[model samples]
Target: MNATQEKHIAVVGGTFDPIHYGHINLGRAALSALHLDEVWFMPSGSNNYRSDMGIRAEKHHREAMVKMAIAGEERFAFSDWECAQPGSTYTSRTFAQLNATFPEVTWYYVVGADTLHSLKYWEEPELICNSVVLLAAGRGEQVTSGELQATAQTLRTNYGADIRFIPWEDMPVSSTQVRARYREGSFAREDLPPGVYDYMTSHHLYQSLEWLSDQEILDRCDATPEERGYYERLATMLTPRRLRHCLGVMHMAMLLADGYRNVSMEQARLAGLLHDCGRTENNALNALGHAPAGAQVARRLFGVKDESVLSAIRWHTTGRPGMTELEKVIFVADYIEPFRGHMLHLDKARRIAYTDLNQAVTFMGESTVRYLESRGEDIDPITLETVNYYRGLLKKQPIPGQYQ
Candidate 1:
């Protein structure tokens, strides 16, 4: 093989504020599946949605930690191009740059099923897809064969793209759970890649970042008069089962927020605990039109104005028009909550949630669509539209004449 043909690389990139096991697993899986020559760990300097104002570690520190976490993985190497480059880092720009530098090499972008769903919204999305073959891992929320066929048929009639759903090994390890363990000071060596725990300890990443600690946020939420009032009022209104599920969602949200470093634990807990406050016996919660109801509850009771918190409440059930990071977190948490009994798709959501926000959003939204389908419930138009919007964003080829 020529030099250009010889180079086959899989790029597994993330913020790596606190690199953990899930990331390593994905890299290994991608490497094995693609038979790639190498997998590079590209730690983003900062995410556009998750800015430096709340970032606990500097770019150099985060990159170093990522380097240390994957130190022993022979196939893994670290790159800081995104961190070194000025301005917000984008995947299209990153891929364009890579292609420019290594025109002869074959590059396969490894992403979760969720990320694959939101390709259209990305910068130069169509161009990006044309440049490389995307390898997407299956998620918990993926539609069943019948549903997929129905949806695919609908898309085929509408758009001339073929949505190839790849079946891959599922990984349940989540960034959220890892962050929670770190916050409670209970993260074991096994929970993370070797040396990551020590790096976090030496760097004091979690302790310094108050929001990274879940217990602290829970304490803060309990201490805050507004959070307290909302909790107490909801306690009186909701049944014990609903309350327990809400608690489970909150716990999961806190874990996810901790893992991503995009939003605070306080925000996650607040949003997660309150996302379904509007859920009432009048409407089966698994039914449609619950998000707006939850939004109303947030406004009427707590008087919250922050876009992230309110958006989270509004889109937790069936997503609304536009969603923010906190909103996406709550949405994903509702679908992937630790308490879910029949979840076989945990790996898919976890894969995208940490690395890409848009992918995470699509994953949860599509999961919502699939969940309603499984129960023989009516599919809400807004939710379906939301899924379609993200599908467009991901540049996925629609199955013609179906689900349009």
Candidate 2:
């Protein structure tokens, strides 16, 4: 409340669905780069960009995640201002209200580099420009100095916008990618803050094989009576971590199957959920020791008589040649799903999964081959066969341990 000393405030707004280290680092960069007094994380309740942001965790979940991630950071804080708005609120409107509430404090808006480019197109860009200085950080998003400078100039020339790009180190992770990784049952421990991942695990965030109550999980997956018994047994038998992985694969497979015409979403769902039914047996022998056994387990134990589901589970590990669409889906889903984020080139594989499912599988195969070769381990004959079959189909050239 010191009228004499000037105070500076900056606001960064987004879904922050599962706020990660990138968001935190940007706030830190802003503080160090712009010499701001404090940075506020404004999580949007429902914005115009909601649909494009992919699946958003519930408003309260997003808020809680942000709060949890920023707990130790003194300069960073969470605000529910936009989330509390009546409807789709604009950045301009937020500033008007912000100024009205804190007239004396000078406010700045920290925009992502891409968002900064389109600032002139936002509602009342002129008023927004006049209200607060714009700060864009290139911590996670890709934008060259030349591009940022050009965009900043355009904003200034067209709308008289005050914008600056702060010094930042690029972080390769994104929330959507993080969510996908979680849904797949894999996450890089480094992507989230210390306690946040644990929180997500305990709360079953991202639908990554969340350890839900038996009935709730069965209901959510639309499990049949027979399927329910198997799921119940699996829930009790498998470790929490393994079960979560299975669920993430199931959710991811269904998601991947949604884009394919030939694949059965139901088959994809079941295959994903039970892909690891024989994981213990698989681990007992070779790396892929469980694939064939998993299919038999699905039939005898789980009662998944649907050959498509069983076959998908069978090939989920070491993919085979002449694999059906459902087989390809489960194989690729197990590789690129959220829980499998640790795999190399996963983002690329995930991106291509929707467009060209076969190509994504090849990419994953190449990565696996490369990784296995690096360790001087014996390559599985089926895995090499699967890679060669898909690679030949796609006309992809040979790589080490591939096409042999």
Global lDDT scores for all candidate models: 0.66, 0.74
- Candidate 2 lDDT, 211-325, residue by residue in tens: 4553544454455676666677787757877786776676567556544535676788788888888876235645587888889888998777898888888888778888888
lDDT of 1 by residue, 241-355 (tens): 6765676577567656655665776888888888888886665655446678778877886676776788788777666546666877788778766446676577666556656
Worst 10 residues of 2 by lDDT: 47-56
All predictions: root-mean-square deviation over Cα? 16.0, 14.5
